[model samples]
Target: MTTDAADKPRAMEEEAPPGMRRVPGGAFQMGSDAHYPEERPAHRVVVDGFWMDATTVTNDQFAAFVAATGYATVAERPLDPAQYPGAQPELLVPGALVFHMTDGPVDTRDISRWWRWTPGAQWRHPHGPGSDLTGLGDHPVVHVAFEDAEAYARWAGKELPTEAEWEFAARGGLDGAEFVWGEELAPGGVHLANTWQGPFPWRNFEADGFTGTAPVASYPANGYGLHDMAGNVWQWTTDWFAARHAADPAKPCCAPQNPRGPAMEESFDPRQPQVRIPRRVVKGGSFLCAPSYCRRYRPAARHAQMVDTGMSHIGFRCIRRDPQNVQGKQKP
Candidate 1:
């Protein structure tokens, strides 16, 4: 694998896709050993230059896709009994997992204490039946399943970034850095991203001035002029989730280039063989991440999300691999 992008022409020199920025690709350390075990064995990876969305897909943007296609998100479709063999019939309605802050401190280990499987909780109604995208046009769209995001990307003539691409962009040219901006979570007492300020599951100080998802680009742009690369919402990636990263080669020159993650079978949940839904890798932590609990607000942080599931904190962005298709934008 070549670590040099010296010969590869920069995407910016050519026309870039609309609403996206060119990310110059080169060799970078892909994972982290300082944080979660899943991010251990940091290894070098090389990816081709591509155009990535400056921010996550916004509510208005997804609405345009839905309006054009009249497509129904997975959360809006009724759960199939065949897919969930033992699920209760009454519980098999159209809905999604919503986050409800606990009244007081609860068991952080049990995520159910904070998450509720509420019916009628789709992308439009983020909280439940009563909630809507009232003033969230600029906020990142959530409650979108893997299929939903892929559909939008296809409709827009783009595709979801692979895990390696996402991590590379998230790093913002700062290879092996602790956080996106710098080593400190809040450098000079300023919150660079929208992460939880207080205890998890119960209290929130809103020190970042956002209790939930903030508008895209509310924070400073990264080295590549990309926004919300860290904490805002977990962005979907194309790679299937693996428990841990593959071991690096004995030689630095042998690093993998454009490496994909584990296959579908390897990404299946071992505990739930009955429901064989393969999980995808979701990059960047959400606003709910806190230091005391999930301190995964860094670029290397990743979480596994079931492809069939869509939660309030999961959303996505798109990327364009072919520079020749720069003129192709969202269809009218």
Candidate 2:
């Protein structure tokens, strides 16, 4: 595969779909060996030119989608009684998982200390019952399940980026760099993205000017001129979750082009045998990532999110593979 953008039109010079930025075709090192186990065995990958959203999809944009299609997000609809089997009726109502800071310190291994299931919680009502999108129109829409993202992408005539594609784009031509901007998480004592400032779960100094989700584009854009790729909220990708990347051939001959994830069946969590829900890859950590705990705020970092559920920290953007197909912006 070609590693030169000169082989095709330059990304910034060409016309891109509205709210999107063109990523020039290129090959780059796709993962990290030093960070998490899932990012190990860093391999080479190539992707064709594609247009990606400048930022994570925002609450106002998602609301426009909902209003146009009368689409209710997964969190807005009632849970299937058959799916839950014998759960309480109250627990079967429309709701979503929300994050709440714990008092002082607690067991970091147990996530339940900071997360709770709140009834009537959805994208609009992020906090659960009374919270609304009031001043958060610019914030990335949360509590959107994988299906919800797909719906929004479909409405916009775009699709979710593959894990390889997302990683490549998030790198912003800074191949193998630690963070999106550079080696340092916060270079020169400046916050480049909205990541957790202090300790995890219990304490957040809000040094990045945000405790929860920050509004889209609150920080500097990467080389591709895309924002919120490192933090703020986790973005969904089309690829299914795998423990690690498959081993690859040496540099001379084998660079996978547009590589995808493993089969859906392979995405099932071995740790959870009873629940059969498959997981998809979510990139770029959220505000929940902290130095003391989750350090997945980097581009190579990835997590497996259950397809059926959407938490308050998960959101997504869209991609357009065929630039010719982009017709301005969707009415919705």
Candidate 3:
């Protein structure tokens, strides 16, 4: 299990939060030089020991939260015209980004070819109005905006993980290995994570036994016994989106301790200066990721997702940095 000293199970007297795994605090190289530019300049990072959810928040779990608190997800709430100037009133209604397979191979650059902003595409109606939780109770909840995730985390007495903490835990003690499992993406032709098998945006080979989202823990857990850290669905992090992790290792005397992302103002997409929406770093790619297209199913890989928006492939998990967040106190 490659258990680290800090992560090793303590005495039974220690109160471990249920449905979470303890990730030991330590320093390790972060980001990747071979992958996307955002993950470039692979630098060092150190994080404190924290308890992270074993799997992404599932539909059933989120339903319980909603049932108890009467919470309404972002996708269920109407958009403010003030926030989105020049937008049609009809378009401003409640909706979310939903994925639909194209008829055949088309221009992969245009994401709109496969994604539709369908009305009533909230967590309860994942596939739009006609869709319901039905058999997907075990699958990770989707169409949850950052605030929605934050609300759930607050309700559960937890917080979303920082990008570095998530990446560190996702590494599962393997450090800079290419894949979560190891160097080989799939050893012996085994599908380690639930990712797109065929070409994305058009077809899915379903080699991993799932065309869409798979149930949590459908694949083998990483070394830390954390599941769905690589694929199944992208997970939200607390860090704001930054173009690059340009921290020069040569300049820093030591690895940054629990490094955070750029400021909220700096998180806006430079391309869309007209829009003021901020972006957050979402780790772990989703089932839609394919080698033909987005190869982001690595521990170091990250994507900039708008804070006010959620897609069919986006979900999240929570972490407790201190015992006080859950239990009364930490045991000596």
Candidate 4:
């Protein structure tokens, strides 16, 4: 059978509609002074009103896009010949990798102990070759790169939210709030977001009633009526990743308006020149988030990932604006 025909999944056409919400633009504290050093010097940023997804894009939503566009994700596509000039022929297989958590601590020196280089892990098959999105129709789509996200946004007539816009919405109308809900991660001893609740890599207390990804609206919405903005999956933003602090004295005191990230670096990764490092910011934290490991759950906290590397905990949301409704000045 032809490669194109062989690659099609039987359930390709099934997907749910995308969920969206409108965010009012105003001034909000963009970074946190207490969290990661990169988020230090919290600054006030103003953003124009825009429409955003109430929740991250779910498996079903992405399945529909695949059905309509016949678009293969980076994980599904084979490595480009020109990119990897001298890569081992064996490593050129077309597939995405999966990281399965074992019951005990394994040696960190060898990544194969946890991350399996599965050849079939894609949006439809999240756990590698045999798995399918049969029951996870509502779960956020995993293993999606920035390119895949951009393709979906283009098809849907929307765009990825900028870091400022994402941070503002994540605040849920509460300026300078520590989290999406407020100061406490779980107010009144309640698990608000889908996050690691128990011992790392071993016992998952399931305090949040979820050991993995939860449904889109599994938790309460923030002040802006956005759900799953603090945890579950890290949503991709349009800004480039810069290590500089938002309030760094080296830069101006006045915050940037509708800020975009830094320019792409011309120099390539000497180790892997095949990969171009374009700057993009990822907001919110993921299920793997923990104080012991990654504490990106904070509003101002951010992380930088290559535009091409997609992981199980990384997903995205879409945005749009009417362009006619201007708003009041952003507050400081």
Candidate 5:
């Protein structure tokens, strides 16, 4: 809830930095009409005009922040035994883990085989201590948790967009368009974003012109002048995660105005039983997105994750509401 006077209005026509866009806000369908259950109950959400990042935060931007503030990511922090009871003593290493893809069909029951816990995998050394951002400075910084994103936002005098604002901006003014560009993911047989071009976790044809993370703004922009909203990486939002429409009998199905998600609960997790879990909603699919597998590229799509967990695909963008527009203010 930090605010700064330095974040005042500037020239609207001024050119935005790389991986950012100006989202002229209006009314749009926030949730999905026929996608994941959580995105159901197609709700109308009105957002005041604001500027948003055209793409997720990149490695270069994150590196600058770290250098200026000397900020350490959550993964680099020591695990507290009191918080995570029964955690193995060996697991309390001081480095972040990296997930490396292996050849073959991994066991569906144990997906952890593909995701190895590598120590010293921070933002600078994404793959491990030996790996560095190097030539991939323009690529989105991954392995960032919600708190990490928030810290970066605060340092930059920005904040994460609410779920309502995120969906409205992500739609790019198409109003219920299936994908960011159009109905077809590969229009005219051309890949638009950095997504898997082959079998899931097995092989990537690199048809989209990238096997892994692509340079930001390497693809076409959406109708609203946003880039890589469909793929590349999953962006974090400020809303707390809630169940799908089918599970919430008391939830409203119609379009909501400046809607924030349900109040934070004591506990929340997608894999756990349908109990109250306090997780945040993550929007936009990642490079791993696919029709045969994770099809969350749609604008109305959503996924949930624990606020503390950081993965290679999860990153974030920043937003700020127009000072004159109070209607879009988030509820306290």
Candidate 6:
């Protein structure tokens, strides 16, 4: 936990990233007790105002960054067998996780039934080898690993938001609201965010008018005038993933100020001790979330993602926490 002078409110004068909105930060409830166990003991947190992109980074934006740097995303590079000692050699290829719709209802408990590691499934080739970003330039760039997003942020002179900052901005000043818009998931039978409308893994009602990623801002903005804060894609946060949130400060006066998550060693996946990759906290569910299975299209919802893996449903946005949005000057 870190704290600056909470009384001394500093106005960070800076040029925000293009298409970003400045979030005037204050105290808010950071987690949820209603949903998953990991989001328990909703705690109090305070953050300083920062500029956040109105939406996730679009494919066009990522393309521009790659063009300028000739950077290859993690999915495009061959996997090192050394990382997974006993893994099958056939599975050790350049690829990414892509969600394949099942023909009928299947056991949702095993996610491997639908999520397949398809070769050549990078950001550009979202679906597979033949797929390309021919018409989806404005859609959120998916299949981006943690390092890929960091590289893009560095190239753009920005930084990824902390879990606290991202949640604060997502809440949009509605201190304890269930959804980004309000308590109801969809008011007046309208689709508020890009989430699954039907059963999980097998069927998609497409009631939201999108089976996959929708273009940025296709949905309405939150109270802070930031779009897609609830869904469309899960955005990366800088904090390491914790099994559960820390209890709120015992004293009201000492509530965590600009708090971050646990250390890297603490974030390693317990289920796979042999694999040393750490997981970070990813906020705001994705298009794959559903009512029956994963109803995580809310401000308080969060998921842990392994730092080394890139999936088709994951994307990211950048933030500016310093007065000047210069390199190495911004805070997480």
The local distance difference test score of each candidate is 0.87, 0.86, 0.86, 0.75, 0.75, 0.86
Regions more than 4 Å wrong, model 4? 1-18, 85-87, 106-113, 246-253, 266-276, 324-332
TM-score of each: 0.93, 0.93, 0.93, 0.84, 0.87, 0.93
Clashes of 1: 0
Q: Report residue 125 deviation for candidate 1 (angstroms).
A: 0.7
Instruction: List model 5 lDDT by residue over 30-97, tens digit each.
Output: 66767776777775555666778877789999999999999989888887778666668777666554
User: On residues 143-226, what C-alpha lDDT tens digit does candidate 3 reach at each position?
Assistant: 999999999998999888889889999998898899899998779999999999887778888888998999999999998889
- Candidate 6 lDDT at 158 equals 83
- What's the CA error at residue 4 for candidate 3, in Å? 7.6
Name the runs in model 1 displaced over 4 angstroms.
1-10, 269-276, 323-332
Q: Where does the lowest 10-residue lDDT sum fall in candidate 2?
A: 323-332
Give residue 69's error in model 1 in angstroms. Answer: 0.5
Runs with alpha carbons beyond 4 Å of true place in candidate 2? 6-13, 270-274, 323-332
lDDT, residue 124, candidate 5: 75
Error of 1 at 75 (Å): 0.4
lDDT of 6 by residue, 1-332 (tens): 23334322453445545788878757888899988888888988878778889989999999999999999999999888888888888779999999999999999878899999898899999999999999999999999999999999999988898888999899887889999998899899999899998888888989999999999999899987899998799999988888889997779888777788888878865546665778999999999999899988888888889987889899999987765423223233
TM-score of 3: 0.93
Could you tally the backbone clashes for each prediction?
A: 0, 0, 0, 2, 9, 0
For residue 298, what is the lDDT in candidate 4?
A: 76
Model 2: C-alpha RMSD to truth? 3.6
> Of 1 and 4, which scores higher on TM-score?
1
